[model samples]
Target: MSERRRQFDRDGFLVLPGFASPEACAGLVAAAERIVAETDVDALETIFDAKGQGHGRDRWFLDSGPEVRAFLEDTPEGPKRVNKLGHALHDRVPEFRAFSDDPRLDALVRELGVAAPRLLQSMLIFKYPRVGGEVPAHQDASYLYTEPVSVIGLWFALEEATLENGCLEALPGSHRLGLRSRYRRDGDRAFTERLDPRPWPRAGWRPLPVPAGTLVVLHGLLAHRSAANRSPDPRRAYALHVIDAETEYAADNWLQRPADMPLRGFSTPA
Candidate 1:
C-alpha cells in the first residue's frame, strides 16, 4: 500500500493540501454562490428532523411556512443560509456533477483498496459566519450504514477553514474503534447525546485547519465534528461521499436516497 493510504488507515483521516487547483476551486465556489442565490429555499426539499426525513419541498413550504421559518435563522447583514445543500446537487448543479465525477477522486479511492467505488452523496456545506451550527462528534456509518461499513468522505475546502471559523476537528485512530450508534436529536437541529462514553480520549482530539482547495479524506467510522463558526468570514466546503459498490447498503440507514453515479474508472457490478 502507498504511504498516503497507510497514513489514512492509521489516522482515520488524511489531509492533502492543494488537492484541487486554485482555478478549479474558484469555479466550484462561483457555482455554489450562484446556486445559493438562485435557489428558492421554500421550493427545496427540507430535512426538518435529525432522522433526515421531512416533507418534500411542496408540502414543507406552502403548507408550513411559519413552522419552518421558526426553525431557520436569518443573518443580521445577509440572507438566511441553509446548513447544507444535500445530495440533490449532484443532479441539479453542473459544477457539483463534474466535481463528483473527477477522475482524481477515483484514483485516490482506488488506492484505499475499495473495489468499484460508487458516489453515495454530495453536499455543499455553508458554514456561514456566526449562525453555522455545531456538528456533534459522530461517525458517518451511523447515517450511511453499509453491511461492511465501506463509506468514505472527501471534504474539499472551498475557503479558508480556520480555528476561528469552525474547521473540522477529529479524534485520530478513532475509526479503529468501530462504528457507534447515532445521536438522538432533541429538535429540528440540536443533538442530545453526549460523547463522554466513547472509547477514545477527547483530550487527544486535534484541530484540522486547511487552506482553500485542500481535501480531507475521512474513514467512515472516524469520530469527527466541527464547532460553530463565530468568525466574520464564512467557511465553505464541498463534501462528497463514496462507498464500495460491491458492499451491501443497509436498508435501515437514515440516508436512503438513491445512489448517484459511480466514480469514473470504477467498474459497476452486474
Candidate 2:
C-alpha cells in the first residue's frame, strides 16, 4: 500500500494538497455550468434536487430551483442516492481517475481486511449560496446499511474550502469507533433519522481546511459533515463513493451506475 493509504488508515482521512489544480477545478465548474444551462427547466416545473434526490425512485429537479420542493424532495423513504450534480460531473471531467484507485487507495481497502474494491456510487455536491445548507454531524456509514461499513468516500473540493464557506468537519479516528451509536428516526431529520450519529455527545470536533484541488478521503464509517455555504461566492465539492469488491449491491441502497463516461480520478475503477 502507498504511504498515503497508511496516513488514511491512521487518521481516518487525509487532505492531500493540489490533487487536481486550479485549471482542473475550473474545467469541472465549467462542465457543471453547461449541464445547468442545457437542462430543460420548462419540462421540469416543480423540481427538487437537494441531497440524495434519487434512491428507489428517480428525483425531479428543475433547471432553475434554489432549493427542494418541500413535499416531493423531503423525507427519503427509499434509499438515498446522489443527485444530478454527480451525474453531470461524472459525465464531464477526466481527472478524478486515481482518487479511488491507484495502488495506494486500493491497498488501503485490501489491508482493511476486505477482498477487492469496486466503486458503488459517485457524485458532485455543489453548494449554492443562502439556500445551500449544512449537513448535520453524523457518520457517512449511518446511511449506508451494508454491514462492516466497508464503503468509504472521497471528497474533492473544487473551490477553497474554508470555515467561512463551510468546510467539512470530521471526527478524527471516528472510523475506528465503527459506526458510532446510531440514532432513531425523527420526523424532523431529512435522510438520516434512522441511524445513530453521536446519539450521545462528544468532544474534540475538527473541521477540515483544504483548498481547491484538494481531496479528503475517509473511511465509510467515519463521522463527518459540513456546514451551510456562508461565503459570498459559491463552494463546490465532488463527492465520490467507492465500495469494497466484497460488497454486494443490496436491493435497498441507491446506486449510481453511469455509462462509460469521462470523469477525473474516476473514469476507470482500480
Candidate 3:
C-alpha cells in the first residue's frame, strides 16, 4: 500500500490540508447560498416535511428547517436553515457536480485501493450558528451498508471548521472495531438516535479543526461525531460518500432515493 493509504489505515481518517483551492471553495459556498435563496417555501416544505419522499433532480433537501426554526428565539431574525442540502447536488448542480467529478478525489480514492470507486451520496451540511445540532458518534457503514462495507467519506471544509463551531471529532483507528448497530431513525428526515450502547473511550476522541478547502477522508467504519455549534459563526462543509463499485449496496440503506445512480469514475485533475 502507498504511504498515504497506510497513514489513513492506521488512523481511520486522513486530513489533507488545502485539498480544494480557495476559489473552488468560495464557488461552492456561493452555490449553496444561491440554492437556499432561490428555493421556494413550497419546495422547502416538500423536501423537509415529507419524510422518505424524493424531490426531483437538483433539489435542496431541507430536513432540519423546522427544528432550526423551533430553536430560534422570537426576535425578528433571518429565515430558518436546514442541517443539510443534498444527496443529489453532485448529479444536478453544475458547481457541485463539477466538484464531485473532480479527478483529484477519484485519484486519491484509487490510490487507497478502491478500484472503481462510485459516488453514493453527497451532502452540504450546515452547522448553523448556535442552533446547529450535535451528531452522535457513529459509523458510516451503519447507514451505507455493503457486503464488505466499502463506503468512505470525503468531507471538505467550505468554511473554517473550529471546535467552537462544531468541527468533526474522530477516534483514531476506531475502524478496527468493525461495524456496530446503527442509530434508529424515524425517517430519512429525523435526527438519528444519539446514544449507542457500545462503550467508547472518551479520552481517545480527537477534535480535528481544519481551514477552508481542507479535505478529511474517513473510513466507513470509523467512529466519529461532531458537536453543536455554540459560537456565533456558521460551520459549513461538503461531504461526499463513495463506495467500491464492486460491492452490492443494500436496498434498505436509509439514504436510498429514486434518483440514486451508479457511481462514475473521473480522470485525474491537471
- Candidate with top lDDT is 3
**lDDT tens readout by residue for model 2, 119-232:** 544555656554346776666565444555666776878898888777999888777876653322232222334434335246867889788988787777777877877678
lDDT string for model 3 (179-199, tens) is 765423344432333345677
In model 1, residue pairs whose N, Cα or C atoms come closer than 3 Å (at least 3 residues apart or on different chains), thus clashing, are none
Question: Which parts of model 1 are misplaced by more than 4 Å?
Answer: 42-79, 182-200, 258-270
Worst 10 residues of 1 by lDDT: 61-70
Ranking by lDDT: 3, 1, 2
> Global lDDT of each model?
0.70, 0.56, 0.73
RMSD of each: 6.0, 7.4, 5.9
> What lDDT, from 0 to 1, does candidate 1 have?
0.70
- What is the Cα-based TM-score of model 2? 0.69
Off by over 4 Å in 2: 1-3, 41-84, 87-115, 180-202, 256-270
Best by TM-score: 3
Better of 1 and 2 by lDDT: 1
